[model samples]
Target: AQSVTQPDARVTVSEGASLQLRCKYSSSVTPYLFWYVQYPRQGLQLLLKYYSGDPVVQGVNGFEAEFSKSNSSFHLRKASVHWSDSAVYFCAGQNTGGADRLTFGKGTQLIIQP
Candidate 1:
C-alpha cells in the first residue's frame, strides 16, 4: 500500500505572497501522484497530477508541483497566493496497477493572512 505524509498540518501565508506546501510519499514502486484542494463545505478540486512525464507539472489557478522520486516527494508551489487560495491541500497517490484506490495524506490547511 502507498501512503503520503504532510509534515505541516497548517501553513500561514499573507495574501499575494508565494507559498509552498510540502508532501512526502511512501510507496513500493513509482506511483501516480496528485494534489487536491478543498474549500469549506466543498468537494475536492484537482490541483495537479504526475504520471510519468516531466518532473514539473502545472496546475490550475497558478499552481504547480514538482515530482521528486529521489526525495519521495511531490510538493505544491505557487508564485503568489490570494485569500481565495486558503483551503486544505491533500497529497494523494495510487499504485501503478490502477486498480488500487488513491491514498491521501492528512492534508495541510493553508491560512491566508490579510
Candidate 2:
C-alpha cells in the first residue's frame, strides 16, 4: 500500500504570484499520481495525472507537475495564481500492486491574498 502527504495544510500566495503545492509519497514503487482541486461547494476536479514517461505533465488552468522518482514526489506548480484559483488541492495515488484503490493526501488549502 502507498500513501501521499501534503506537508502544508494551507498555503497563502498573493494574487498573480506563482504557487507550488507539494506532495510526497511513501512507497518504494512509484505510484501513478493525480492532482485534484476542489472549489467551494463543488466536487473535486482533476488537474493532472502522471503514469510514465515525461517527468513533467501539464494540467488545466496553467498548472503543471513534475514527477521525481528519486524523491518520490509529484509537486504541483502554477506560474501565476488567480483569485478563482483558491481551492483545496489534493494529491492521490494508485498503487500498481494490483489493488486499484486510490490513496489521497490530507489536502492543502490554497489561499489567494489580494
Q: How far does residue 111 in candidate 2 sit from its true spot (Å)? A: 0.2
- The clash numbers for all candidates, in the given order, read 0, 0
**What is the lDDT, from 0 to 100, of the residue 114 in candidate 2?**
100
- Candidate 1: how many backbone clashes? 0
In order of appearance, the predictions have TM-scores of 0.92, 0.93
Which pairs clash in model 2? none
Model 1 C-alpha lDDT per residue in residues 1-114, reported as the tens digit of each score: 336888999999999999999988987434689999999999999999999889999999999999998899999999989999999999998855667778888999999999
* Candidate 1 ranges with C-alpha deviation above 4 Å: 96-98
- Native-referenced Cα lDDT, model 2: 0.92
Which candidate leads the pack in lDDT? Answer: 2
TM-score of model number 1: 0.92
